[model samples]
Target: MTGTMQLAAEGASDHRGLIIGLFGAFVVATLAITVWAGRQNKDADDYYAGGRSFTGFQNGLAISGDYMSAASFLGIAGAIALYGYDGFLYSIGFLVAWLVALLLVAEPLRNSGRFTMADVLAYRMRQRPVRTAAGTSTIVVSIFYLLAQMVGAGTLVALLLGIDGEAGRRWVVVGVGIVMVLYVTVGGMKGTTWVQMIKAVLLIAGTLLITVLVLNKFGWNISALLGAAAESSGKGTAYLEPGLKYGISDLSKLDFISLAVALVLGTAGLPHILVRFYTVPTAKAARKSVNWAIGIIGAFYLMTIALGFGAAALVGPDRIIASNAAGNTAAPLLAEAVGGGPGSTGGAILLAVISAVAFATILAVVAGLTLASSASFAHDLWANVIRKGKASEKEEVLTAKIAAIAIGAVSIVLGIFADKLNTAALVALAFAVAASANLPTILYSLFWKRFTTSGALWSIYGGLASSVLLVVFSPVLSGSETALFPDSDFAFFPLSNPGLVSIPLGFLLGWLGTVVSKEKADPAKFAEMEVRSLTGAGAH
Candidate 1:
């Protein structure tokens, strides 16, 4: 064979071996854990909340694991590489969201519900409409989030394996779908918890190792590193500050606020994050877990600043930029270059481990999201609506497993269609929707006695509709042009984020609906709702 053909064959062989090995190891490990956990799962509670047996520390780690997804791993690093200090904005926004969760949402949510966030909302309201609305929101948000993650996984796998994009994407979606199904179906909460905990530690350690080495190479001087990054970056010191450049008109201020709002409130409203509160043994444990999660997450974000700048200075933008024209590849490329050349011993090993961890991150997060969506559909919608009362343990668990498979299938389909979008952007949309549709209703339901079922339904529908519509019309959705009227010269919204608009709408709609339906609400239910939300009275 000619030299060119021989080189191509060797490259293809290496790519194929890497993909198969990493993917195979992930599947085997996930399945083993699932089967072991499945044997221990005897009831719905075990399937849903791991029998609420987790200690504060374990649950905290799992929370951090779930929260720090592929978006955090790849997206933040890429953002820093491209945008400098603008990227750290995401870290700050994400970390601040934990404060909202800890001070406002955590303990009350744990005290109120058993499985889904809807359970808490429906406690004092009419069960059918409340459960229906909350379940719809949960499914919508979770699927959107899952689609983003699956897309990221597919793209990463394709890049690493040197395979056709479509085939690689399908493999990622299928791999994650099957693993998540097994995780929720067999191991239930127990298996999911351990998986997330282990993955979190590995992810942190892996990133930290890279950060340490990168710093060591720079002689432990942060200022020197930043100066190098600033000099090398095309944007200069402006990248170190927010809004010095890249402003579309004077709207940079609005865009900054919009992004901040989405990240801050979004975490508290996320179905997967809220459901974690149920995993802790008590309300107090849930609160403590939030505190621990915040600290861990904070440290991780801080490391990303170093890693992103390191990649910016060390790898340089031109070499890492792909034909696709996104910054997400910077982290992986940097790891390969710094650890060693792609085929070098150090580089190859580090890249393999990072790839494995990235794959694991996708699996664990999708599993949690799928589980949350399943529980919301099965328990909140099916059991509450179809059965008209509490479901037997067997029935609830069975329905949940079935729901898991169904949702996973939907995610795969969406991932296939969303190949062109950035996973981080899609995840941000999920956060915006969650913040808009679910957060306000939850907060009011727990703290405001005036809240009624009518109010919740209206708020949920309004927020969901407005947020989705705004996103579809935002610049991110338009692609090459603005969205508002498609043909119109003016874009409807200045910022791509909709949380700033939709979140307030949710609260206003809820308040207005409550006032109009005042006479229909039962005042007696107020006392009960307060007790359940604050002290776990009647939770079982």
Candidate 2:
């Protein structure tokens, strides 16, 4: 911490012009795309599935963008900067999760689904109850993840825009909520996909530029950079080891394993990411999209390692901690340090550009989340359940738009209150819920012939309930100094992430329910679902 570089707390005049110009340009371009895409939606399919017109490459970029939220870009980098090798472990888990998505979920999902994950789950079962369960799981996961993004948005604006008061940060959250609502309600999936594509490319380019600048400062020697990082980190060589973040004790190791499991299995279950498969035309395209997304995501995370270490070596942990207690500001502060220090013209411009890109990152992710929740509301709950499959395409689409506004408003309020939580940890809880609630049900539905409707209900409800209940009682809510309630300790669950227990419980309940219930499986329906899932018989 001795070599820590002081951050310049400059007024708005220093970088406001550049930040506004870049952010405004992105907003205008995305809104224009939304308007154009809105005109192309002639039915519910067009609105939810983007007309199934996107190529593998376009969907690939969008998928990468969707996965790499501010959590991946800023949170992981900051974690690595602060915790060293432990932070890099998250990068490994994130990239490896795509293998689960690509190999296990992508092709089957594309062949089976139309608009939502519920489509796949309810393909063989009695539709109403199954769809209701699916819709509930989808909304729960979406809201948890959405709140994390909203909180990250407010925290990022407060730090980057120099917003000092709580009111200022609250306004930032509201503004982001409005922008995301517009993206989903007007643009639908097509516009959101395009915006994600653009944001991914810019994020990759920005990361590369900062990485090269960091390397140049280190005389293009990686070993020297690592050496410097070790020296700056107070722990010396321990900074290069894995025990810094999660290796404190046996329980922490279990916690680390829980995190990895959630990160890996959760990607396939996430509603927003699962829905993206429907945007492609064929099963083959879906597979290819996943392959492309893995490549892009892999490359970006590799750079995050460099960015994190470079920040530790150059900007030092002390300044990063000072900027934000969670170290979420490390990447932006690194940009300021490498571009020529705070007051220099290069520093101001680069910082502003990166800040704007961060805003775009948040916008694209929240738009995807909002779109997924709205689709669940309209397609599953309203069209299929409430209206008994009699709702028209026009009515369903209108319902989705309205749902987007409601979901966005709720997220803004939660974000304003939850801004103090760590963005990365919040996202990890979201992944845990997705893995526990959605993954087990989908797998059994597609693979097992005896999976009855009762089994589906048990799996979804059991998983969702267990995840939510465990998290509420876990250390994140009220325990220790690091807990949300610093002065209290009511957490009974030792692990913060509930994936290790809940995922197994989800599968076990599905199996137990299937065996105990006398509701015989419909052989004809199972045959139909298997044929369609394997051969894309009825897939559009």
Candidate 3:
């Protein structure tokens, strides 16, 4: 190892005491917040929606906290350092996605749903079938998202501890799973929202700090930074161009398009994000909440221009890949470089603080995902479908807590197997699943008067099965060097992401099922739903 490399390893070990202290401090603070929030849970509303008490600005910060996961901080930076322009494209897809959520879905979703997405779908359809399908889709999409966040957490803990193998990452995954379970089962939405609010502030502050430092390194010259990044990338101007990563072959191009489609459409469909709308009191607050999020998130992504290219120029792509093959440690390594060289005190402090923030990002997102899935399971599936709305309020909340533990266990197992994949790419797959399975159902339920229960079932199940099936057979899972299980070779799908095919198919399935169904639409119910969804009349 070179001097900086050796010092980096030593610095990580030398600061082990500091690193662990920051980690412990963050955990204790968030746990205290969670426990305190738990006392506010006097009813189902408080448990599920934080009593709809948060202001637009507060909820917006929490949304930013929930939305900006490890993928935004670590994965995107690494991608930019390695792949150049294509890596920054992830930020674009995620940012523009909010526009869809804002203009089309946010107001109606907030007004129509009480706790879960199923509340909207079940309003004008057969309750049991629609609720069951919506509940299942919610859990699946949440798990896919949870898997990516946990994988990022595992990589982060392994790097900070200077652990060299998958074994260490696996232990981190297990530990994170336990902590997130506690966050949800004890704190519920109130605790989760507060933690996310804190995390969002830290993430923005940390990213802003790095962005300013990178600019200072180049004497505040943007051109110099880009020139150095391109030169250091070893690919000249190609690094700044579009084709560096995804422009290699037609298949790769198709995969890139698929990923873009998923990212843009997925935000509106995400169960956790949709549930966030219900945490506010009115349609106006929901709109205001989204407005705040778009502004904060837009500014943050703009800063990634510095974060990604800064890493490329200072840390070098070779050194970044050396640290983590997926470049998941790019941000921290860049933090270390800008603070000073590896062994410097400044480097150590910035590295530990940034890594702690990244860890907090992982914990906050996982808690939100657990709450979304578990709430759906208890509210939609257990209480409504199985118990026929006979379950008590306390019984439903108890079921949600149990579901959090079970879901956490499943996430731990999957996360251990997926430690090698890029966090951003894994998150894109989650987007694809959400876009394919949940988006169609949501749009149809809110807009199409003739949409029937059979249509919802078919759309949810068909889109979900098709997306997962294609993913299972795609090169992302096997048959490639970067595949989750590279030793296996059963993949036959041409594209890495299934969105190019699955999203369109989901829409088509919903329409076809609606036309073919023998069940008749009830105009009275549809009219009631339209009014409630439009004006927030009689919403819980």
Highest TM-score, which number?
Answer: 3
Q: Clashes in model 2: which pairs?
A: none
- Candidate 2 displacement at residue 211 in angstroms: 1.2
The 10-residue segment with the lowest total lDDT in model 1:
1-10
- Each candidate's lDDT (Cα)? 0.79, 0.88, 0.92
Identify the candidate with maximal lDDT: 3
Candidates 2 and 3 compared by TM-score, better number: 3
Clashes of 2: 0
Greater lDDT among 1 and 2 belongs to 2
Q: Which segments of model 2 are wrong by more than 4 Å?
A: 1-8
Give the distance in Å from residue 344's predicted Cα in candidate 1 to where it truly belongs.
2.3
- Write model 1 residue lDDT over 1-540, tens digit each, in one string: 223223222333445566568768876887797788778877787888988999898999999989989888877777777778877687888888998899889988898888899988887888998999999999999998998788768766665555454665687678777778888877888888888887899789878988887898789999988988887787777867776433535676677677788989999999999999998888889988888898889899999987789878887665545412445656666666577655565665556667677778888899889989998999998899888877787887899889999999999887876665655667788999999899989998888877889899989999999998888777765633323233434346656788889888988998888899754666788788787778877776
Off by over 4 Å in 1: 1-20, 244-248, 481-492
lDDT of 3 by residue, 209-327 (tens): 99999999999999999999999999999999998889999888998999999999999999999999999999999999999999999999999989999999999998888777888
By the TM-score metric, which is better: model 1 or model 2?
Answer: 2
Error of 1 at 43 (Å): 0.8
The lDDT of model 2 is 0.88
